[model samples]
Target chain A: MYVILVYDIGEKRVGKMLKHCRKYLNWIQNSVFEGEITEVKLKEMVGEAKRIMREDEDSLIIFKSRDERWLDKQVIGQERMSTDHFL
Target chain B: MYVILVYDIGEKRVGKMLKHCRKYLNWIQNSVFEGEITEVKLKEMVGEAKRIMREDEDSLIIFKSRDERWLDKQVIGQERMSTDHFL
Candidate 1:
């Protein structure tokens, strides 16, 4: 299965979050990640993200798509040029 | 039907995009918007969005779910606290 992970955080510790997410998935866009992951891995990572994020001040949304073909994506321009900006 | 609208852009004309999107959907988060729209309305709005955006420097993604019940969304924290930030 393919999963798209996007996160919203209250703190400015996006560096840590980005690093943590890179271990399991590709850094596709700002706070957005996607890759093939098993159901078991999805559950495990979701649990880990929940644990790592602030319950009241952070949110992690995982859009699980059974197939990537159903999603059409297009990338253009210098959208994410600054790594120093928010992740 | 329910539609999820997300966009990536190179220029800094987010204020116009935000205003345009707000006219048709609810601004849920930065560069993210969602609302219940009919199939006809979805198509119309998508065409408008495409025409309104820069073809080479902007990209728009629409996730259409016939039923919103299928999506599991959890929102927490002060993630989108700033309006001056990127849309």
Candidate 2:
């Protein structure tokens, strides 16, 4: 599946979350990552995120689509980080 | 169409962007929003974003889908905002 993951983690643990997410997805912008991954990989990534997050203060949200084609993306202004490698 | 909008604006202008986006979509997380919106409304929102953004530093991205059913959302940890009004 293709996924866009966004997180708001406590300042202290955010670095760790960023590092872990980078291992599996493209870092598109601040606290946001997106890419394609198999179900097992997605599960693994979610598990790692759970470990890095503070249940009371941090939040992680994933928007999933069966295929990237179903999602139309538009960008306005500057492109901070490119996910063109996936293209 | 259902759209998930995310923006990375300069700190000084981010508040304006946030306020503008809220008028059209549901705030799902920090700098993240998602909900159904008409094509006309989407275009209007994009135009407003361009005006508020700095050509060299800010970015606004929109991920659009034909329908919300085509997108699946998963939230982990604390959800700072609820988007149930759209449901």
Candidate 3:
């Protein structure tokens, strides 16, 4: 499935979320991450987020597109993929 | 319904998308916006995007959640709502 993850949280924890997400998906934009992930991995991501989240102050949204072929990913700004490899 | 819109485009046109998007939705984060919108308004927004989009070079995605009540909005960063009125 195609998963789009967007989050809003406090400062320090945001870093943790980013690190946690990078393990499972590609970081597409500030506080937003998206890519194809398996059901197993998706649950793992949710579990990790749940483990790290500060429920009262943090918010996380997962947009699940069962079929990506029908998913319209539109961009009106720089393509994060164009950037040089961080590694 | 709840809508999540994300985009990626070239430099010059990116501004246009941002301006166009702001007309119908609140700018939540860079290149991402979400909120409740009526079907009528949703079409209007989509029409506007389709009209302004440079089909070859730009991309726009809209994620629709049938029921906002069931939508899970999780954030691991700052809340855009608390940033004080921009106007």
Worst 10 residues of 2 chain B by lDDT: B78-87
lDDT of 2 by residue, B1-87 (tens): 999888888899988888899999989888889899999999899988889889688878889999999999999987756544431
Task: Return the top candidate by TM-score.
Answer: 2
Poorest stretch of ten by lDDT in candidate 3 chain B: B78-87
**lDDT digits (tens) for residues A1-87 of candidate 2:** 999999989889988888899899888877778899999999999997898889788999999999999999898876646444331
Model 3 lDDT, full chain set: 0.71
Superposition error at A68 for model 2 (Å): 0.7
Superposed Cα deviation of residue A58, candidate 3 (Å):
1.0
DockQ of all models, two decimals each: 0.31, 0.83, 0.23
Whichever of 1 and 3 has more lDDT, that candidate is: 3
lDDT of 3 by residue, B50-85 (tens): 787787767676777665554445544345552333
The residue-level lDDT of candidate 1 at A7 comes to 73
Q: Write the per-residue lDDT of candidate 3 for residues A1-87, one digit (tens) a residue.
A: 777887776787877888888888887665667788998998888888888888776777677766655444545434455142442
Candidate 2, which segments miss by more than 4 Å at Cα?
A82-87, B82-87
Each prediction's RMSD to truth: 4.9, 4.0, 5.5
Query: In what order do the candidates fall by TM-score, top score first?
Result: 2, 1, 3
Candidate 2: residue B60 Cα off by (Å): 0.8
